[model samples]
Target chain A: MSEKPYVSVENISKWYPYKGDKLINHEKKFIKANDDINLSIQKGEILGVIGESGCGKSTLGKLLTRLETPTAGDCLINGVSTKELIKNDMKAFRRSVQIIFQNPFDTFTPRDTIEQILLRPLKNHNIGNSKEERRKLCIERLEEGGLVPGEDIMKRYPHELSGGQLQRISIIRAMLLDPEFIVADEPVSMLDVSVRAEIINMLLDLAKLHNTAVMFISHDIALTRYISDNIAVMYLGKVVEYGKADEVVNNPGHPYTKALISNCASIDPDDEREEISITGEPPTPLDPGPGCYFAPRCFMACEKCLKEYPDKKNLSDTHWITCMNAE
Target chain B: MKNNRLTIAAQAVKSNRQLMAGCIGVLALLVLMIAAPLISTEDPTIYGPDVLNGLGENGHILGTNHLGQDVYSMIIYGVRTSVKVAVISAMISGILGVLIGGAAGFLGGKVDVIISEIINVFMMLPTFFLILLIVALFGNSLTNVMIVIGITTWPGNAKLMRAQALSLRERVFVKSAEAMGETKRQILFKYIIPNGIFPVIANTTLGMANAILTEAGLSFLGLGDPSIISWGQMIYAGKQYITSAWWICAFSGIAIIIAVLIFYMLGDGLNKVMDPRYNKRRA
Candidate 1:
């Protein structure tokens, strides 16, 4: 990882209110999808955010891409705050940061063929001066994204292609604009496992080739570690641990992080030792109490851990943990 | 690739036998209707006892009306009036309904509420009675009939289109477009209207047949334009001589049935072609 960071997320939080019978009573409850998330991505580095379902990993990805703005605090792209950047340079910011969605089927409009999809971003950003040049550039980019020739795919509708091909096309579209930062939220999650590695490899190569900063969000810790230079582990809307992927995998500090790493069956099945198992689902984020969000799922939950939110503790020169026992 | 799409449409056309037969029958009738002015030797209104002459006349193939005018010519002239009013009015209703419904459905919220309220108010009135009152007050001209049908027919199409648009508005692609910074007009025209308004258009074409038939019924009840020699006018003319001459009314009824069947068939074929579910299931 480089010394200088390309993107800095400083104490960001996001909440979505529940709409139900509670509304009739004039009561509002919010889902704390992201809580005080602070992280940074170095220039030309891939930072992977790994977590369980409903753990706010996807929400944080959306916040980074400006699909959904943070409720509090701010993310700084380079040196300018995201809120200020949006006012003066919204188009540039959107062009600079692109996102790859999980479901490739919904990524493009059904009426559009592959060519139209590729041409849309190019035309929107005024990347190509003419149609012929745009067409050539699209084919070239598709080839770089591992789609051969590309015109055959261009003439076809999305329904005619397999999940893998569609996903590759989506990736090609994002890369076509040559964005500086990318937030790929489970880009390969919907595809078959047999083709997952190919996509991950392609993403890694593209990141290197384009020098794009990426925040890869996924539930699979092993996959994230495979492509990511840095890793951030989230639990119940809080980053429990983050650092170099290899370091976090080898010496996980937080109890929540330890369970997540161990839970991955791919990492040392024969090294079965006495393990920590926290039962039950995570607590509802609506009106979450002042304590470690992971406290409910931690075996080492103390009284103080239950009553007070733990301050982010530095674990190493590059790692930080929001756990009470990070020391 | 283009050939494949052609073959698909061809297959659809082949499979729908009823639609094909109806279309052929309507085509034959349309040609006959258009050719009536040239084919008929007698004027529709010129009176002569010799014209009522029966089925095997020297010139009148379909026989003649009570006024001794050729039923064939009267039916032909009626075709022009009935078709002109119905087609014009159906087109008017279709364009207006699609616009009103599509905008309301796509815009949603307060716009939806207001448009829906207007549609609801129109729908609550007895449609036939409204048509009758309008025709009664406006003096039953072909133009007045067209106006009445156009104004009354729109509410149903608008309501249907609004419902369709409302559902399409919730699709993920629409949300994705919003995230991508697509304008509202682009979304409406490109996505919402294209996907939502096809059924309304198909339904309107089918509804035209019904509109024409309804106008014929009103004319039979002495409510249609007295000057235009419509199919319903021939029926009303033959009503007094019901026992003596049944061909005038019977054959005119056939013309109306054939026209209606043709539209229904076209609507059915278009629906089968346009409906996404049918394509998905069959493919």
Candidate 2:
């Protein structure tokens, strides 16, 4: 609250036109992927975003990277509006903000060797003087990402490597720009359980080393709590809970965040956490009327919760929940 | 300097002399193919007492082969056969490749699996030998050679288009382009086809040249249509008198080389014209 944020998202709503609905219709239906989303990250801080599939976590990541523009509002990086930056200084904006995609395999072009992929960003960004210097940088970055024998891996194609290796390479590629902010959109979701920690730790350490603000998105709340300074839990298209990771995990205010936390598999043998069961699937994003999106699935849903949507209710100076019914 | 690349490229093509040679050579060959009868009234099939005539002896222009058939008339006439086979077969293969490979790649799932398997199978078979086998079985008529070459050579183009289409559809720009309201056909033609078709196109020129060479090989082996006096047939008819009438094979071989080389140059020039990278200005 005291320090000015390095990266701040200001009520950016990304509502995709519902493909099943006709675009020519006067009242075009929308799948609100991220609606009035607000969050901020300090320099070198990791903001973990935990949400289930189709909960707009990836959409939020895309918005952060300016891959898909928001339908309304803007994201600010170092106080420069990303939306306006697109027209005026898009190349610089791209250099400052990078995204690590979920699918490591698809992120890379198959035809290009790993070295070419590493060198391209440098070439486009004009990082090195000559091809040789750029290539050496590529090798150094690859080794830093824990891919040993960088020279060997650089010459090989994406198909030649493991998913974990490719994911590491993807991180290395993103961080190669020495970005001001990065969105690691489920960087380890597709990876094996053993290597997930390695990748996450690598990202965290690198972000800290570069003083890079990061939006670490994943469905695993426990893991998010482990890596993030702040955690924002998304449901449908809205952030249901935003707080310190420990604050949210220890005392989840929103029914959805509690539900998400309850579903996590604990490592402790004596763990006796109660699983809070809620009813019904998420209603279609196309016509999510006046009520809260989680109201139908919320265990604590009441008549008021069904009839009206709620706004953020402060828990502490830095913690808040969107549910009005929370104690 | 900041002008549209395409407009500049159009101007560049107009001014490029190498491209001009290719176009002029192609144009001259087309004229030869179309105006063979008008240019020379002498029947290329007819043999006379003007045997083994060397380079304009006894009123024959290039010379006569073992049959005393005027090599000049025969070569001018051979343009029709050589160019026709190449053009027609190249079209057939290109069309076949785009359709099959495009469907397989764009459709995906069962269609891709089946079509890709077929492509792999086709790739395994040596294309030239396959064409030879088919021509041998079905009888080596001009039409048959053209059709066989067309069918056998298409798999390479199909494989390329398939790989390109598969990869292109997944590209970030292409996906965003599709999302921004371009119709499938428009995207296919504009984004997909243009990107992928270059490899297919590059393959096509080689295909045409190979077709010419294959036809020559077939004729040398006495498998071509006996009625037409093609360059290959001319070569065949002159092989027996190699020492005395070296001009017969030499001239026919040279004509073949010129034809093949022109096709290559034409293809290379056209490739340059279409490629966006060619718009770069020299210092």
Candidate 3:
């Protein structure tokens, strides 16, 4: 809605040090979780981040939610730098940027009831009036997340619910806080395939209704395309390609992106046979060099792609692609 | 999230007749302790005509001790003493256990090794012998008994908690909470304590039973606190007139058995209540 972005991630990176010693010395190696990544999301926009496991997609979600501080660069919220924020500001940031984790079951503490679980965040923010008001608010939020007859669900424990129901409850918990930005890190990956679309559609509807920006992270490109307006393709902790969701999925620019689309079952099954498969598994984040992170696995990688990291090239007024040749 | 585990435990108490019976038995004893003077017809310390009337031409229903004090009244008084010793001692052990165990488990390396060594030393000491030595040295006071039991019982619970903490420290939620910028105090109190409360509860109930039984054995051996009329003391007093009045000791022994059974059952109920895996299956 505004010219300026709601949240901007500027050259942020996270490197996890792996201590080699089993003893107390703390000698270690390092694994780069995210590497010099710059991205931005405008107010009320949906940005989907697609990547395989261990590519730091979840790490990105964690950083945005302030669950983990980025080792480098700054994550700015509405032009206010996160680094300068005091304890109260950090709490405000957390309230603004919430995350729904992949495993719906493990996200909640086992000791609490559904009502108690919902009440915790409300209590943390000091929201609502009395116990009765909080209970009424929780039921309303659950209904907003598509769980009608929320009162019945509220009285039952998490284990008593099915996987799909649990996920809806998880979404209700996130929605109750009315966060401005949500990082849904594969929120439906743990659910039965039949219910995944329903959950995704509910999320999209909720986002639209509340004008909340969402960074929908998933390994399933098809699902990402179904929900996202813009898509960022990540490989081995690097965003190899990113643009308008349709363009990136249909007229893909990067070799890694092409390979991924071709491999999808939604794409022509015959495309899988003719498509160039990148050689070897993706390189580990540890010992990653200066060149393109995907060059090792890129079928079209040249000496130039190997020698230098790619920059984000403007594909259209609204689309940006990250690849050397895309320029 | 009303823990499914708690619901399952409630169901177990409702459905299992034996468990319900044991629980009720314990509840009744607790009520009796609180209403001791009201419930008992006689002053438990009063001396009367060699009061060993078994089948009754007397006011005493469960007969009387060598001192002619009602065995029933003495058993009622003992409930307060035995329950007090067990609960206080178990609490001391539980608190100390979680602290030492949690610290050692959470902060591994040398701390774990040192705690393990301390636990091993305590564990190696013969249980009955250690209790006897401490009780003998301290001179048979109720406070002395509680102190000995409390200090000695913790090593086992500490070792248990250490192992539990070590495992819990690695759970995804713990790591996630740490990554969420939660303080160490928050993690330990909010996460570790709630996750680890089951063992402490179970151990405490079991400890109460252990304490009651031990006190009974000590009193039966004439090593009881001379000023207090306990179940074990009643049994000891009855032993002197065993041939003429088997009723006194039998009644006291029955009291001891019921008390121990109740506590053990409470522990079992709690174990069922606190375990989630079982709840999942049942639910």
Candidate 4:
């Protein structure tokens, strides 16, 4: 890890008002999308966030990118608070950070051709002086993104291109501004298995080329482990475990993290490992009871685990787990 | 690129007989309107000594009205009036509705609520009567009539545009644009409007048809500008003399019907051609 973090998420929490039921209005309810998240990424480091579908992994990405303001605390980029930077200079903040969404099909405007989509960020940020220069830059970026003979694909609309092709274009769009920090929210989850590795490798290569810090968010733990330098395992809007990717994956400290890792299909033919399957589904985020959010579904739950939320226990200098019995 | 759209439109028009017929009728009327002055032997509004001249008599091909103005020339000039009013009112209303409603839908939140409330208020009132009252109070000038019609008829289009904008605003591309640090104006015009404009274009064609019909109705009620001679005005001028000079009312009424029908067909054709759902099925 670098001496100074490129991106810092400091106890940030995002709570959305729950308005599902109209009759019961006495107590204001909120869906705690992201609760007290604290993580950082060094320059050129990939921090993978692995979780279930509604674990607020995407929400944390949104917060880090400044797409959504945190309800409490703040996220800092290069030591400057995102909220303050956004208020002070939104364009500068935007140019500094970019996001790659999961759905490549939905990322580009239907009206815009691939060229137009790529040129938008360059034009907005005034990357190139002239239109020709911008066009050249776009073609160059497309080539770098593994699209050879870029001119052929330039005129094609989003619908004309395959999902994998569009995903490449999206990556090029994010890298267009030469953004320092990138929040890739399940960037390859929507892609086919055949093209997934290619896209991932391309993303990693591009991030390395730019020396860009990245937050790789995904539900696929194995995929996240392959690309990430460090990993944070989240459950019900809280990070249950945080450590080096290989360390955490090999020796998961938290019960939730252990179950999550075990759930991923292993590759070895002869290795037989019993999967740890938790029974009950994760509770709704709205008005979570006074306990660890995972306590309801945890196999190793006890009186203390069900009564109070656990604090972060340092298993090592770098590895931190938020379960009472993890240590 | 524009040629591609044109080709698609041509293909769509060729495939549909009603659209083809509508195009022919509209084109023929447009040609007549353009050639009105060159084609007419005498001024349409000029009064002559020979009043209520029958068809094909004394150089009056379609006969003269009660005031002895040639009905053929009047009908030709009436096309100009009706087309002008329809085009102007449609342009004004279409632009106004798209701007207000597109902004409301794209911006959403409080702006949507406020604009939606205004649209609701406009929709709740009897639009025709409100237009009549405004025109009466503002004085029945041609410009005033066009403006009133344009302003009064936007609520429906606005509501439609708002609905389009609302759905488009939720599109992932729109969110991506925002994430790219695009300004609201850029997102609205460059992204939202372009994608959401098809329905508005279809709505505008329909609105033009409505505007032409509304103008005719207003003119028939004697609220049209007297300086201008429209099909409705010609009908109003010849209504009392229906028993004596039947051609005066007959020809003008037929012209009005044909114009309205042509516009309706064009609007319907445009709706079918422009609808994305239809295009997807065709693809």
Candidate 5:
């Protein structure tokens, strides 16, 4: 990891108010999708975000990619606040950051051929001299993404391609733009297990080649740990723990994090340990209280943990946890 | 199961009796409009040798009006008038509706609310009466009537286009385009409009039929352009002669009904073909 961060998320929060019922009688309740998130990634560094479903991992990715702006606070990319960026600069900002959506089928326009899809970003950004030049460039990019004989693929529509191949094309599009940052929100989760690694490896290769800052969001801790230098575990909408991938994996801090890692079954039958299960779903995000969100499900929930949000207690120079009763 | 879109659409149109009937009617009228001068070189406004000549007398196919005008020539010119009003007025309304509704749908926020409110206000207004008031206020030339009907009757199209735009704007492809650094206007024009245009087209076909009906209604009230001939004007002129020369109003009324029916069928055909679930279930 570099000493300087390329992207710094500073105390960001995203709250969505309940529709048609706001301020009618009682206090206006807002769903805290992301509550005061703070993390950073250096150029060429991958930050893996692991969380249960609807724990704000995808929301974090969206916020990083500026798909949805932070309701409060700002993200700094090379000393420039994302919130402060103006109208003309938004296009450039968008060009710099790209997101790979989870659903491969929905990523590409069904109406557009692969060539049209590939050439669209290029044409929008004025990357080519002419239509013929853009077409050639598209074919080149497709081949580079390992869809060999890209010429044949150009005529095929999106539905004609497999999930894995479509994902590679999406990655190719991101690479074609040469974005500075990327948010792969469960990029491989929707694909067959056999092709997941191939897709992830393609993304990893692209990030390494372009030196792009990547925030890989997924529910699989091991996958994120394998691909990311640093990993942040989220519970509900709060980041419960963040540290080096090895440290988090070897010395899991938050109780929620410990249960999460231990739950991933292994190949060896002899490799056995007592399971620390936090059963059932997390609490609703509507009007979240002023305590740790994980406290309700935490195995080591102290009385203090129920009433107060914990500060980030440093476990090491490179590791931290947001639990007051962390072991 | 493996048919491409164009072939599927063609098959759908072919099988749909409503759409085929409408297409034939509209196409026949279009053909007649194109061949207007060749169909009858004789001036529509010119008086014939005899007044109130019945059908087949002196080579008059539909006979002559009380003014000694060739009923056949007047009907030809009336087709020209009705077709022109329908086409031009529908075009104008469709364009306006697409633009306004598309902008409102894609740019949702204050702009959306404002545009939607405007649409609502326009929707609430009685369009026929609105047209009537405008025509009554402004002198009723063919151009004036066409423009008035075009401008007033756009709210239906706008509402439809707005609904389509609302759905299309949320599509992943649209978001992908937005993330590609395309400007709001560019996305609105290139992506949202094109995808959402099918519904607008189906609705506007129906609107074309309505435009003809509206024009006929205007002319039937004796508010038609004095210089040109129309089916409604022919009907009005034939009203007093109903006891004797019933051919005058009857034939023009029939023309008006035929023109309106065909366009309605065409529009209905388009709707069925465009319905995503319709053919998918068939296959």
Candidate 6:
């Protein structure tokens, strides 16, 4: 890895205006979708982000891809802030970063054929010299996406293809630009279980061959562990735990991370272990009171946890936990 | 081989008996209009010696009016005039509506509010009276009538296109295009317009029918160009001699009714066939 991270997210936060009851004269509210998130990824690194729905995992992906602007802080690409890069060189910024959406079927224009969909990004970024050259490049990228005989699929429309086929085409479309960083937001969660492994493998292989950094967001802990070098666990729009993948999974420091690991479904029949299930939902993001957001649901909740939010406590050179009790 | 658009349209027309009937009627009328010179014995405006002649008199199949002009020939040629005016006017209005509505719906926010308010203002006023006022003030020439009718009839279609564009703007594919760094023009024309255009196309046929009716109404009210021989003008000319020449008014009225009905049926069939929801249901 190089001395400088390829993409760095520095204390970024995103909030949305929340409309309260019209009948009441209450103050305007805001939902803290992402709260002071900090992370970075080097070249050829895959950082897995695991969180339940509404935990701001997708919001973070949007922030990194510049699909949505951060309400506070900034994300740096190669040491330059994204806002500056966008203002100065928007086309370059777009070419450098791409996103793979969750729902493959909805990602493509229904009127466009597979060839048109794949050729668009290359054409937009002016990647190839001529139309004929771009056509060849598209075919090669589709093959890299594991879709054999790309020419046959090119003539077909989105409705004609299966979910898995469309998804592979989407991945190929993102890769056609030769982007530096990609944010795959639950890319395979919408596909069938049988096809999920194939897609994941193809994605990882492509990322490796391209030497591209990726932020793979998913709710599946086992899958994240298999593909990611490092994992960040999020709860209620906050990163409750951050560390190496195996360390976070095997030696979970935060209580929420431990509960998440135990919650992972196992197939072993003879193994007997006590499952730690957190009760009650995470508090609503609207105007959440001070202190730990997870204190209400944490089994080890204490007076200090309810009174003040815990700061990051480093356990090792690479592992960090945000819980005071964990130290 | 996969079915192309033309083949699918042909199949759609063939499958529905009412649509087939409507197509056949409109096709026959169109042929008659095109072959009017060959089929007519004499120019419709040329006066003859036989005045107020009954049907089949002096070889005039539909008889002669008070001016001794052949009513059958007049009706045949009037088809050409009516179609020309309706088509031109509908095209003008359709283009204008789609442009305004598509821009409003896709751009949204303040643009939407402004355009929508303008459309509402137009919609609230009586459209027919507005057309009449414009034509009356501009002098009722054929071109003036067509332009006035075209301009007055666009607000409704604009509202429809705007609604479609609004929904289409939110589709995931549009966002995907934006994320790919596509320009605003590319997204609007390539993605938004093509997807939201079916309703506009379907509405255009209805607009043509409405334009035909409006033109006929104007001609009946003596607001039509004096030089043109339209079905409405025929009825207006024959009304003074109604007791003696009922065929003149009745036949022209029938022609107008048939033309408008054919367009309405075409619009209805197009709405069903072109609708994606309908296609999904069939699939």
Model 5: per-residue Cα lDDT over A190-261, one tens digit each: 999999998899899989988999999998877888999999998778898999999998899888989998
Task: Estimate candidate 4's alpha-carbon lDDT, on a 0 to 1 scale.
Answer: 0.88
Task: Name the weakest run of 10 consecutive residues (lDDT summed) in model 6 chain B.
Answer: B1-10
Candidate 2 per-residue C-alpha lDDT over A22-74 given as tens digits, one digit per residue, 9 for 90 to 100: 54676767888889999999999989998888989988888887767799988
**Tens digits of per-residue lDDT for model 6, A59-163:** 999899888899998999999999999889777888788889999999999888888887887787888899899989888878767788878888889988989
Model 4 lDDT tens row, B1-283 = 6787699778999876777877898898889988989987889878987799998999889999878798988888889999999889988999999899999998888988999999999889898999899988989988988998889888888988888889988777887888899999998899878888777777787787788888888988999999998988888889999998899999988988888888788888878876667668877
After aligning candidate 3 to the native by TM-score, how far in Å is the CA of A280 from where it should be? 4.2
lDDT accuracy of residue B60 in candidate 5: 82
- The candidate maximizing DockQ is 4
Clashing pairs in 3: A112-B1, A112-B2, A113-B1, A113-B2, A114-B1
Candidate 3 Cα errors over 4 Å, as ranges: A1-4, A19-27, A267-273, A288-296, A301-327, B1-7, B10-28, B31-42, B49-73, B95-196, B213-226, B231-258, B265-283
The lDDT per prediction is 0.81, 0.82, 0.79, 0.88, 0.86, 0.88
The TM-score of candidate 6 is: 0.94
Regions of model 2 farther than 4 Å from truth: A21-27, B1-283
**Cα lDDT tens digits for candidate 3, B48-97:** 78456665548787877666777777778888988887788888888888
lDDT at position A38, candidate 2: 91
Per-model DockQ = 0.30, 0.05, 0.21, 0.78, 0.59, 0.63
- lDDT, candidate 1, B222-274, per-residue tens: 99888878887778778887787889889888888877787778777767767
The alpha-carbon deviation from the true structure for residue B84 of candidate 5, after best TM-score superposition, in angstroms, is 1.5
DockQ-better candidate, 1 vs 4: 4
Angstrom error at residue B68, model 6: 2.4
For candidate 2, lDDT tens digit of each residue in B1-283? 2344467556766866666677788899989988999896478889888878888788888888777788888888999889988888998999899878877886678989999999889888987778778878998899998898888878888987898899888774344333222345655665567667776886787678778888888888888888777889888878988898887888889989998888887677766765666666431
> DockQ of candidate 4?
0.78
Interface RMSD of 3: 3.4
Task: Write one digit per residue (lDDT tens) for candidate 3, span A29-134.
Answer: 6799988788889878999999878999999988877667788988888898877752556456656777777887776656656887677667766679888899
Write down the RMSD of all candidates, one decimal each: 3.9, 14.6, 5.4, 1.9, 2.2, 2.4
